[model samples]
Target: MSLFDIKRTKFNSSEVISDFSHFKRRLLDEVYETKDELQLVCSSTGIFEQFIEILEGLFLHIRQTQTSAPKIRLLFPKSKKVNSFLEKTNISDLPSVEIQYIHEDEFQYFIAGVDKSISLFSEPRRNFERGFNDSFFNVISLKDSVIWHNSAIFESLWKQSILENKVKDLSRELNRNNVSNHNFVRILAHELKNPIQPILGFSDMIQNNKRLDSDQKNELLKIISRNARKLDIMTNNILDYARMENNIFNLNLEIFDIVQVIEELLGDYTLQVNKKNIKLDLDTLSKKIMIKADKIRIIEVIDNLLSNSIKFTERGQIVISVRETDQYIVVKIADTGCGIDEKNHKKLFSKFYTTDKLGTGLGLYISRIIIEKHLGRIEGRTNTDGIGSSFTIKLPVK
Candidate 1:
């Protein structure tokens, strides 16, 4: 017998249908007949070709509605064929068709409804072919409780599916970031070791060489002191970075001479600048440009900028200048060194990013944090002539 004829013999004299093809046809017919709304749920809609036919039928049904059209929603389990089905149907062109995807495991049957007059359910199947009919299928009464229960079930599954996809995306992003950080930490450890090896060797020599002249001993001692200071700075940068990340680093704000801080830091680098024959100069609008901030952190910010300039410039000049506005203090550190590329200007302060292979890349990052903590911002731009870069800092006066 034909599918409709078989459904007639299988079902009572009601709206219920047993044949799969008859059930699908009647569901589409109801969508065409519905004056209120239509909803559908299924594990999968079989092949791409079958899904396209259903999409076409839905569009046609909407078109045939001469009066007010019914709202339509389709919920189906996500499958490999979803993208292809959407591609062929051009679902974006049909705004009336609302669809959402759930995990394939979450939906194990077929259910469809139209208004409050009809509801249908069927055993899950890979396709709609009648030859493979192996499970129960029938339309049920469209009572208030049955309709409410099915609607609630679909809503819960839809929300859960969206959450699952978001969590998966976040987990993937975190994994990638963790791997990048792990590699950077390994490099930072190597940088810390470089200064220590020289410090240890020089200390051993100074201790053993008893016949050395006073000048020779003093020179060795200075070398030891420089290396030790370098190691100390590196260690402190990393510790500060950790403390800042954990939200435990607090500022000790005080009023201090901004010029004095710059001059003192410059004096510390005098020996190194003389060694390289580079000129380090300072300029200020006043002898005392007082500002309220963490004195030590401000010193750190300027020290990092000066160090960067010295590292890149072989025989050029570095100028540090301080000036004040009505409500802000501005410090400008200009260099005559190899300038950074324009494209890299924005990423210069990112953590663990450096142009030099041996650098730990934490200096600029730490400087930015300290400046921001003081209600200030730090920025660097290549000089107009392209010979070097200038780092500018603006701190609030209040």
Candidate 2:
């Protein structure tokens, strides 16, 4: 159950392996070791039916492919009704699947049928062949050292686990929904902003006048600009959302200093920082932390993240940090603000989900789209006590 990337490796691989069984019933590690045997182990708790549907769909897919290895030797732990359910599934339609039931009473030999390399948890959202070097699940391998080592651990937990099909079906459904939603976003984005230009122009003209009385003009301008900017933000949200749906949005990549970008963006936002009486500090240790990215899109990301911070903070501080690495530049924006709730974490990138009294709720969603386009990632987290929130944007350091 890797969440973020395809074959994402970290220095903490050992620690990650220790926590592999955390989602016991919700996880599945189906391994194919050789030409003779195939093993499917699942953590069975609640989503058993969904898992079975996914596995069935996978076997259906395998039948579609003319691959030589459609022949599968399916095995399950000793259980009467569970074996009965497996028996009822029509394998005749699936000419490729070779089903078998391994009773607890007697079983001496189980061969894993993985050829070349193995991908135990290949997700459809990413490249299928991608795999983790460290095998996290407890699967016994009679083949290579890497395989044997991991499989040895797996055998101990085979009885405790079940064969599941959690992902294959969900991937299909998600892919379909993603395609439809992508089209809808494109249509909706254009519709929302067509009526917004005139409002912004008039607001700008009103605010720039020298003839009107100073106080009244300022107040009227504030209202006009505020509403106009609101419309503009929504329009941006739709555009970003539409772009994200296609998944090929490019970064317009170029090399620029991280420190320079933040410094310039901060100049425009200094007024808002002052208005909130917040201590806005930039902690970029280096004067020129060079990075390759789209400056305009990155600026948009920062502006939205900062705006979110300002909305929650009364008079607290915002600390911006930039750390450059060989592969990525990690930029973190920590804010002392009214933190977000844990329940809302998943919806942070969801369109129009703002808690602010005056916000349109599209900024962070748009920011995420732009960030992802740059081969980057954005994450938001609140403090443990829920008193503050931090937004981190990591961009490739190419």
Candidate 3:
């Protein structure tokens, strides 16, 4: 038969001489000798072990040749057996092996080819009497126009396999986030109720107690106000979290001098910082670095970060630094406070999660949402000396 013509070879029990050795001697060397590319589609792991010798020969040739080997790509049906086979073989570490998985229904036959010159499609035998050492598969070779047609078919399937995997990954991530958010909602409901109950009872008693002295009434009013402020903060955080989850949160963009905003915030927080005997300072790369963003939301982000720093700090300093890059506006809030545990860093921005019992836990979470809405990100790290934490916010300057 001509090299480009079609040929069929069967290796069932009836064809004893045309078994594994005969097939390997006739076809394996020619396929591997091709310099351009190799492609494979295997429907089952049953035939995988049978190809070890052939693959070993191919890899040995490439290594000794000291030249780039033909690009080799393989597509297989998704299965535990196939995954195990790949892991055991370390197929990914091989020089030219690119592996992908397709749905079982999308592929049902075995195919292999080397370059445009030679290719084979096989149908597996179902009624084989022997196992392991048996050769009960049928293969047919095609070349020229027919080989090109088969390559196109494999390429389409390869693209589909990639798209399928990406979609599955996205779906799994969404499901995990949904479960996490659902659990936090329950915790948030409990947190909100904890302070509300006390506020309600205090207000009721204050209104009904006709003979209470002025001093007694003032103490109850102060308690009510304290809890009321807590409730208001929690309520606002819940709304912000909800808006972020639903993808409805938007930045009210405006151009403003960011350095000025930081300076003003530090001035306003001076009294609070003084109450704890903490030194508050600001360092600026420029006196007036400007950016376009939601001014109010940015202030909220800065306020949340600074509050956390001051709350944990008893007798140290809090510093706010402003700097700008060619493409980003960078702000760092660092404090010599009771530093966060290294292990809890990953959980810092999670809703209703806090390391301290006194904190509402929603501050960092809502701050992250607001910064992200402005096309920015917030990241925190504990100081290496183990005495403080620093948070950095980077906003794009487009």
Candidate 4:
């Protein structure tokens, strides 16, 4: 389904007449009319990638426009990794247009100058697929104000963000990335052997050592079996993530019950929670909230969210909730664990970005890609009091 279709399903004609649509239209109309210098604040890593593509196209068009003014500036997330990505970007080709990267490590959102108007990209309350409807963006123009307020805020951050001390040669960075990939591949092979070799050795030993108790042998077999399956899953995740990175993860879209996918994913995570002695709570959900999407891909998203919850939550309860609006189905996996800092929230979904954790970081990135391909979105939000975090997904109901 198209984004428009999904939007229409949730918002009726009357609601558009009285409040939201008119307000949004007015805001956007003002932005279009104002010829303010453009400033773009990109909050998330996914948004940063999209920012690059969108700017590339916009600058190319501006070059073609006979009377278009220079109206572009960029704000970067202040981080060592983001600085690396920004340094690698080539903006020299568009010499006529000016683009400056400002790292806002402390701000709620970066301020983008859109012509004379300043636009804000606020981090949403929940970032899952169904949370888009709640996202709010506001724009203000500052053509008369020579001494800019947002400029000072942005400048302060840019100053604190470290300089490009080392301009990593393209070839060198590429080589390093390649080494990481190869290392992961090797790890995959080694991990596979870790389980198989133990199983094989234990089986042979148990058969020969007939004096051993049956209970002891059975326990050994269980350990071997469990590790083997864990190894298999890790290998599959690696393979699937690689495919997703290459942009070849195809979605077999069909109408399926969203709740069923949630159930299946929870079934797997429930065992993990039990093993860890963490509380697992789930809401009673309708079994037939049908959504047109790639079933397997959606299941992978739920699995990732649940897995993330389990990893972070040491003892507190992990809650999974499902609800359906007129046009959307929302699933939320919330964990009471180490809540994310304000700065690193957006990077959580970024491909290859991790909080120094165990698994390959591609899980959330691939999950977002899957949702976007199916015309949905996924987002994350943290507790106000540092209790835990919630990752939400919104899928369009067919």
Best by TM-score: 1
> In candidate 2, where is summed lDDT lowest over 10 consecutive residues?
159-168
For residues 105-150, write the lDDT of model 4, one tens digit per residue. Answer: 3323324544433433233333435443344333333322211334
Clash pairs (backbone) in predicted model 1: none
Candidate number that wins on TM-score, 1 or 2: 1
Error (Å) of candidate 1 at residue 72 is: 78
Q: Whole-model Cα lDDT per candidate? A: 0.69, 0.54, 0.67, 0.56
Off by over 4 Å in 1: 1-177
Question: For residues 302-326, what per-residue lDDT tens digits would candidate 3 score against the true structure?
Answer: 9779878988889889889888988
Return whichever of 3 and 4 wins on lDDT.
3
Error of 2 at 269 (Å): 1.8
- Candidate 2 versus truth, CA RMSD in Å, comes to 24.9
Write one digit per residue (lDDT tens) for candidate 1, span 117-219.
Answer: 6666655333345543443345654544344434534444443344344434433543665734545555655665566565555544554445777788667
Q: TM-score of each candidate?
A: 0.54, 0.44, 0.45, 0.48
Scored against the true structure, residue 140 in model 4 reaches a CA lDDT of 34
Q: Give residue 292's error in model 3 in angstroms.
A: 0.4
Could you tell me the TM-score of candidate 1?
A: 0.54
